[model samples]
Target: MTEISKISLRNLQKRFGEKVVLNGVDLDIAPGDSMVVIGSSGTGKSVMLKCILGLLRPDGGTIQLDGNDIGTLRQRERNALLRHVGMLFQGGALFDSLPVWENVSFGLLGAGGISRRDAKDHAIETLAKVELDAPTADLYPAELSGGMQKRVGLARAIAASPDIIFFDEPTTGLDPITADVINNLILERVQELGATTLTITHDMASVGKIASRVAMLHDGKIIWSGNASDIDRSDNPYLNQFIHGEAIGPMRPDVSTTMPKETY
Candidate 1:
């Protein structure tokens, strides 16, 4: 049986003044697939994600969720669609003033109309899934370590059991072991929920552990996409250059390498 795509983008285009980003990009993600989009900093990866989330408007092209064109949705309709999405931002993006339980239950309280007691219970359950115990629920965001904070963020994102999740550089700042733990937690939780996910990260180790499929973004487009296992064998020069972190390849030379000549 063929799987149906849950999210599809066709000929997507976006620009900021003179800078063009997302030049006719196209992508398809089937339900329950973990797609990791890899790219160097300053590529349109985040922009593409923002477009999908309706945080930014694209100049052209179509973004469809379950065959519905979300790009054309009004603000209220778009927000309704976004209720199905859970996002774990690069920096965790937790509110410093809020306690851990409140942070975890943020969406539930705001959107789900869950009562405080019920929300707390749900928060505790979600926190347990992320390996966080109930004792930590009363602590503020500043009281937690980076790993713990990320766990809280994960708890918050999954609190409502959203059908789609977006992870932006989820493992970027953590140590290797912590990053691995977070990746495993993400995999486990996502599997448990059977949710579709799109993650953007430069961590190759993360790519190996979390992605069923990998797509590389370059020059405002998806340069390559395939099964995660096939990334090592990909012959695309851009992919080769990126994966190897090579300065000397088909990719443009770094502007920082040039220096002014000094006169004696």
Candidate 2:
């Protein structure tokens, strides 16, 4: 049987002032599929994720989750839908004020009203799932290294056992070994839960390791998408340039004009 799509975007469009971020972008992710969206900076990759999360309202098009149009949902309804989704932000975005376990169980404490003792137990279990030891649970975010913090963030994201997970720049700013470990952890967790995931990253290594399907975003649209094995043989000039990290291609010259000077 064909798997149903957990998330679908049809002709999705978003704009910040006069700048069009996503223009007629369409994609479908089957339940339990791992899709990695690769793109250069300023291609609206983050915006696309935000639109799906209802953090940013799109100017046009539709975003559907389980066949329901969530783009037009009221705040309460949107929050209800978001309850089933988990997110690992780009920066590990942990609250410095909270201890590690508190950070990891924040969602459970707030949304599920899980008792503190039960929440701590769940947090410890989730942390172990990410290969983190129990000792790190009491340490503050400031005391942990970057990789440890990321693991904590991952633990927190999965604490709710969300049906869908969104990973933004999961491997960014990590040493090679650490990045690989995180990638493997992501794969293990997704497989363990059979949850659909959408990841946004430019790291080709992470792409090869974690993605079942790859999509290339450019000029506010998904210009190309295919299975992971086909990526090396895609023959699409844009895909070639991106995966190879080349300075010259159909995608290069256009980059200079895409982002504002201050962003550089």
Candidate 3:
């Protein structure tokens, strides 16, 4: 039997009609590994993340979580598997209607992980871990600044103490300093949890700070992967063009792939 990874995607394929978003993608994330996938605006980074999270069904391939093939897991089994996962969406996708405490504890409250009476307290505690104070917990998502919203989202993601955390563009829409701040918080929290992480971002600064291993995705495949420190020294023309942000290179701008994602 092939040894299992903490999370593995083998021959993963996804397409929107004829648009091949992910083509035979192969990647493995081991336990407690901080793996970052870097790519330009599109190239199916989000699509790949969605596939692992079971939000989208792949046209072909398998995603295994802790040695178990996710495609084969029953609905209840899948739900149980998902309980160990946490996600911080790119946009701090919080419910505007829910206050910070409720937002932070949303999963715990909804998933029967915490009692109603204790949920608020747990949320407050989690918020503190991200350097969000108790009072901020009373505000709605709309009331907070972009950075605060990100912190609250981080608080929510870590509230359940998930074994695996996914960070989607963790520093998006922030000033450079704020982005750095969020990156630091993410690094601290990931280390504190000793949890495995899969981060998808184009931000090089975030990559420098958060990645234990960095993978470059282009044309729906990982073109290169190595220690984060080695990215600048890579000889691959595609990788060199990408990391240096050069216009004239082998990589033609993938106009076919849009900013958010491929259209349905």
Candidate 3 residue lDDT tens string, 85-127: 8999999999999899999888888788568769999998999
* lDDT tens digits by residue: candidate 2, 1-264: 113778889899988766888988998998878999999988989999988987777889998887779966788887877778889999999999999999999977888767999988888989999988898899999999999989999998888889899999998999999999999999999898888999999999999999998999998899999998999988899999999999978875453455432121
Which ten-residue region of model 3 has the weakest summed lDDT? 255-264
TM-score against native, each model? 0.92, 0.94, 0.95
lDDT for every model? 0.88, 0.89, 0.89
Q: After superposition, how far is residue 221 of candidate 2 from its true place, in Å?
A: 0.8
Candidate 2 regions exceeding 4 Å error are 1-3, 253-264
Candidate 1's residue-wise lDDT over 31-76, tens digit each? 9899999988777888889888887788999988867799677878
- Of 2 and 3, the candidate ranking higher by TM-score: 3
Question: Candidate 3 regions off by >4 Å?
Answer: 1-4, 256-264
Better of 1 and 3 by TM-score: 3
Instruction: Give model 3 RMSD, 1 decimal.
Output: 1.9
